[model samples]
Target: MAYQVLARKYRPRRFADVAGQDHVTVTLMNALTQQRIAHGYIFSGHRGIGKTTIARILAAALNCRNPIGSELRPLAEPCEVCESCTEIRAGNAVDVIEIDAATNRGIDEIRELRDAARYRPSRDRYKIYILDEAHQITDAAFNALLKTLEEPPDHVIFMMATTQPEDIPQTVRSRCQHFSFHAVKLVDILGEIRAIAAHENVDTDEAALALLAEAGDGSMRDALSIMDQAIASAPVEDGRPRLVAQQIRELMGTVPNAVFERILQAVNDNNSAEVMTTANQLLDAGNSPAQLARQAVRYLRNSLIAKISGLTPESAEGGAAAELLQISPDEQRRAARTAALFTEEELTRFLQTMLRTFDELGYRQEQRFHFELGLLKLVHLRRLLPVEEVLSQLAGGGGGSAPRAQSAVRPVAAAPAPRPTAPAAPADTRPAFSPFADTPNRERFQGISVGHQPEPVPVAKTAPPVAAPLPVAPPVPVAPPVAVAAPVSPPPALGVPPVVAASPLATPPGAAQPVAAPVEVVSPFSAPSTPPPPVPAPAPIPVAPPAAVASPFSAPAPATPVAAPPAPAPSAPGEPASHLQDAVVDALSNAKQGSASDAIGDANFILDGDTLKIQTMLSKIMLGVVVNADAEKILRLAVRQAGGPVNITLLPADPAMKAAEKKAKAPRSGSAQAKAMEHPIVQRAQSLFQAEIRNVIDLRED
Candidate 1:
């Protein structure tokens, strides 16, 4: 007779024989008793978990020839004595057809099976077809089987099984009743195998059996096979050499817990030499570098679980692994005690490093380099503390570092020193940057520091922005330019005379007009373009409140051959006009100078609104400044310095029109009036209208 391996020798023959699957067996037995069997059955589960075994048992029960009932009904369990049951068990039952779909997965083979399935069973209660690895069938074969699988003949039953349930098509799977099987637990696997070992009369200890069972990973057949191999190799001692864990480790080349403990101790000691030396010893013992890395990960993973759950060694996976690996109790205690050396963060980091080493071993051609460097790296790495602890140390709120340098940790001593009566030194005010010296704003940016940025120089309050606005011809109405200056400002106190401003060419009122000045700019003939009414000395203009009293005309009105009046100084008699202007400009320039200082020069301001506003007549460049944003900023600063702090805004100025009057008496040129009347567009209009041209007027066409 030929020898049978333990996997097949211990194969389950009955549903009750399938261990760890009582849930499935109990349900199936009830279904059999009630005679409510599904014609199409699909069993899905991992390998070596009794999927095919259970399917064969179902076939046997369905085809059993012997009866157990008092009258004639057959039992769900096979009698095992009759021809049908015996032949099926022996794999020779003609009525029971078994197919390895992995080898015969073509559509033609499935079609042939479908045709043969139509025939009635040959001298049996029913015909059964058990197809294994059903997912290996091609799409065409699955499609061909769908119809037959869904509605098969009453005499035929279909059973399908696969390790990979996901690969099977839903169309085929939906036609069948599905049952799922799970891996047997570690305890159950060891209990069964140890019983088998005792029956075989092999004196095996708990350590050897546990190691074989753990290597099984969850499958009973796998555990039995590993044990069978170990038993065969067992040397004879007192009729049987006890199967020892050391022998098993040698056979399997597994890294024992001692190696993991040694590496961890070296890491705690920060001894790179010991870490590398211990790792190499494992490699010398015939364990692969990746396997060593995996062992370290397992050890650390167990430690983490134990630490978090507060579980003792007996209750944790680490205890099981240690017992199975044959690690001595004293060595296990030493390793377990080291768990105190790691914080949660440190444990997490250690696990990460080991996992990375394991992954890199697969892609790296130099596995030895990865193994040596990995353990050394862990030794060199510093342990990490919790974030809260580090923060508290920096804040001087947590316990200080250890005294006398017992540990590597250095405490943060950032608590402030007591301040003296004198103020602390201000941050360096001098500029440290010199690279921008070539730019146009270099001078302005100089002497500016982070904490002490250069402030805009405030305007002197002795005089308001010196403005004397001239009425120019109205421009085509465009979008109003944004005003960046303050209100119709405090009048310029020392520039143009206020009373003399009644006429464009008139001198100061209440002051004698000088005669025979070479700067006489009177034109021989002037057009009637301006009003002749003498506006009061201090009465405000109605059209546009002015930003400054600028000398509007290009012809110099002789530098009033006399010193202008000193500005009204701000007094305890309430804030003076100049001071109010200064205050308002200062507040504006300091706060919003970057955006709001553009209308400083051109604004015809209105000081009535809470926010000073520029009138629309804000016009052409004044004093060679662009009358734009930069100019506006400078002028605002000046007002702030000269006057006092005042809030500034830009609103449209007053819109009252100026009074229009005849031009004052002056000599008129005959040639100029004749020239105006002789123009072709004018002549055509006069002729077309049959009107006479009289007293021609010049519109100053230039």
Candidate 2:
């Protein structure tokens, strides 16, 4: 009486009905047959791929009293006639408890379930708990049910399903076996659609079916729903369904293959007008800019795939042919001939432009204009050289003649030179004035000279310089001096040097005359004279050479006996005096004396390879070496010299470490140090000489 949505109507009823999940189904059937079912199971996969469906089917199989037999097991298929199977399928099963974890995600609900799980089942073989979207369960609920899940009652079974399996915690995952459901494949979905179409007696074309399958994108429920819509919208003539490609294409609002071909042709021909016309045509045909952009991206992607795989239309696969213009055999042969004309990089650049255009269209109100402009630019890009090419030409390659000509047609500013010199000045008479002539110090003009050299005049000395005396004729009457208190003598200057006066002049008798005072000048070089004590120089203290101060215990004066001069040291020189060796020995000795070296020897044994290897081993123990060679040697010698008695183990050098060491030590053609570091193995051996002595002495005594 009522129309049921295809998603609900086509919901999987049994394990066999589930698509693209044979591994999950077979495993569950085997579990039921062997009676080795766990108290809980978790199912996970993408949406609309039957995670919840499989959970329900498993619930039925677990409680099925009358089971159908198969080759591998006696209960592979649960009989739908059985009361438990029928009830579960109808969603009225008393024993099967289905809970939506999304709605009931709380500690209290889980506690109640845990308490109720203690009771025996009312009327079924097992009490099933199917929790959908189990990842949505609250942390408290998971913690509360952990104990019950680990050791649940014999009759209670938990079946959890989630689309996002990664969100589930490890504690829950470890408690139950996980079954992953994959998306249904396109071919499998098409098969299911065909079956449905036949049952409904709808006449659908192969191309239309392929479009539906491509649009479904690996979801059976979505494919069925799309098919239902397509069938309902099919134009009817004489009470028959007219399901064709054009009708489906109209329903989807996708551009046709011919339209995509025309767009590509316009771009290849560099026809801006055609590109704009095609864009307008698409708009007039009621296609949205976003949809057009998506179709263009798909078109470019298909072309690239076709160019790569060399598949022709006749031999092309279903979705590939519908979305991509299938290359004809002749075209494939031509593509090979023209392959050299366009490189992989060029195609990639073109595809990138299309993608960028799509992203721009998202923000653009005038998307058609932007789309047309993008296409025009992409078409003309081949005729124009890249900016890098132009730079290379200007850099002196001379390969950008055509591009340079096109660029010159437009007025562009020339590039500025890196270091432009100042222009030469002309010979001019009147003193050349500059805005910076008012410089504060005449010292700045010391090195600079004007062309006109004026003669230097002799100086006339000793004239009182015709001193302009104060006008003597006009005398103003003077007031009697007010008895103002004399200004207190200025406090002594705080380390300010005393000022020296050049000359002094006396004032007239009745005039105010300034007084001059004598000032003391301190010279930096002058020393204060002091009386010397009359004492004869004590007989020169008998001098002792440094050699005389050496004690017997002190290292016997580094035998200058003979400089066994400059011969190559022995391969295993005994404890070469390196700061690194001293540090390592100190650390080892400290760790041993303090009883903190329980794992030090083992840790050292692990650091004998590359720096990363050493770092990794030391990181585990929260102890690391401050010295490079010392850490490497301590590790090597601890293992080698420990004499198999101590619990020091040397992990074999990691292959990656060995490779890295080889790279580090390998002689680089131009580098001096490369030749000096030596092979890593040799360097590692050399580093161990001192550590070997220490290890022998320390562990041998132990």
Candidate 3:
């Protein structure tokens, strides 16, 4: 007799013979004993997991002749000795019809089966029709079988089997009883293969059996089928075949577990070279890149499970994969260490990459390229250092010299910076904010203080009036006051510039006390010959703290005869002060009055009676120079230089000679201003220019 494949030879005949499908067997057994079986029954499960096997068993139980109970009490178990059971097992029963739906899936076939359902059984009590791969039935055909499937003949039993039940139309499915089957566990497949090997007297080690079981992937028929092929091809020793894992690996062109284990160790150590080298070695050894990718997925999956839970295959996948239990001690240690290397997120990424690579292996023409790229990708994953470890390495600079352990950018720890130094300030110099504080030049307030107000002075009966301050100019040199013996005045008020008084060398020994003195130093811009008439002496000088400079308002120190006033050379009569221009410029330049000196240099000097007048095109330029205190000193020196005291005034280039002559002709007394505005010529001039009268006076009145 010809040999039958283990998949068919070891097919389960009884519901009790089915492995790892207690749910379906129990429900069917209970339904049979109760005689409550549905007419249309469908079995759905993965391929080779007893979908058809259970269908045949259901038919045998329905038509068995030798019953365990009489008339009203039917038996659930089929008697193997009975004719119905034997004929169903041999596939020779007249009343039992098994149709392959993969081929007979047309509507015509479904209609024929529907018509045949009306007839009674020829030799059995009921007719049994089993359609395998029922999902392959056409949509129209499934629609055609709906009525007969819902209301079949009393003597007919319709049992259908399919690997995928979802493809069947819902209308046909609702008319049938459905049962789903799951894949056989790995241990279950291993046990079945061991039993078959023992029955066949094949010598095999547990490791070899584990390899065969893992290769089965999770199907009992596949495991048994592989065992049958491996046994037949096993090397003969003393007329008995020897089976070993190494021989099986060579025959299957399987990548060794050690190759994967080494690659994983490399992944943990972040060693890309070793990872790539080992991967290449496996490919060189005739291992398929696709197979390497898939095995890597499983190996990594086991490690992930080990890290999360423990290192037990039972815990890894409910003891489904028997090979996981057979790993060597080194493999176990390596897996545990490798498991510690990856985090959950990292493991997930690795699994995802491997799964994606396995999928691409079929589509990619160059399988080695994708396989190597994926391995390299895993190897280069950052050396995942713990938080505490990374911090310690940073704290102790010696640890970073090893390979960097960063994924994207290197995690370089920066040393802390040295503390900054604060600037020191002198206590005495620090600015005081209080307004009443006696500190001069409040550092923060730029030397201004509340108590620095200018003191009020009573005008002296004979002293010249003080001039107004000048406008902005280049910094001028200060005049060297010939050691003024006058009392120091108080400092000016906060925000006001200081005023200096002119003082000269002592008078001659025989000179009488100053009474009606010639008007002092005259400004070149002055319009009047003498200073404004003095009224009275200044009030008593004020007193202030000793830390402050002598109060500018303090009484003048009595002058002793320090030096006699120098006598000047007598000038020829009516001599112009033009020779004194150099003397005036020299005095102003020494006084550092730049603006006044500039104006003096730019003007022409002329002598007018006793007064020296400056002639200029623009009067505004000299306005500041004339008001300048230094200009006063320059004018005095010019007066003494021209051989006598004389007042100085500024005049425009175009003189008002005609107006002066007319004014000399028309003036009366102090009230001459009113008479001049009433002149007929003045009225005509006002009307012609649309001008208003401001004031008018005789030039000789003062």
Candidate 2 Cα misplacement greater than 4 A, ranges? 67-75, 106-112, 317-343, 350-702
Predicted structure 1: lDDT:
0.61
Candidate 1 lDDT at 199 equals 77
Question: Per-residue lDDT of 1-702 in model 2, one digit per residue for the tens?
Answer: 688887777788777888889998888877776878888788888777888888888887778886457432255676677788889988999899999899998988999889988999899989888998899998889999999999998899999999888888789899999888877776678788888878777888777787787667677777787888899999876676767878888888886656766766665555668878888889888898878878777656656666665544455544444334333333333333332334455556667888998999989899887777767765665455566666765577676544533222323233333322112222331124432235333222221211111222221222122233222222223223211111111111112222221111112234332222111122221122322222222232221111111111112111100111121222122222122223334455543432223223222222222221222223322343332345544533433332211222323434456445433432322223333345576467769863221121123343
Residue pairs that clash (backbone atoms under 3 angstroms), model 2: 604-635
Q: After superposition, how far is residue 634 of candidate 3 from its true place, in Å?
A: 69
Candidate 3 shows a clash count of 20
The order of the candidates by lDDT, greatest first, is 3, 1, 2
Off by over 4 Å in 3: 69-75, 312-337, 383-702
* Candidate 1 structure quality by residue, lDDT tens digits, 304-359: 65455454444434555453433333434544555656656677788898899999
Scored by TM-score, the top model is: 3
Q: What are the per-residue Cα lDDT tens digits for candidate 3 across 213-258? A: 7777667777777777787889998888888988888777776666
Global lDDT of model 2: 0.57
* lDDT for position 41 in model 3: 88
Q: Could you tell me which 10 consecutive residues in candidate 2 have the lowest summed lDDT?
A: 556-565
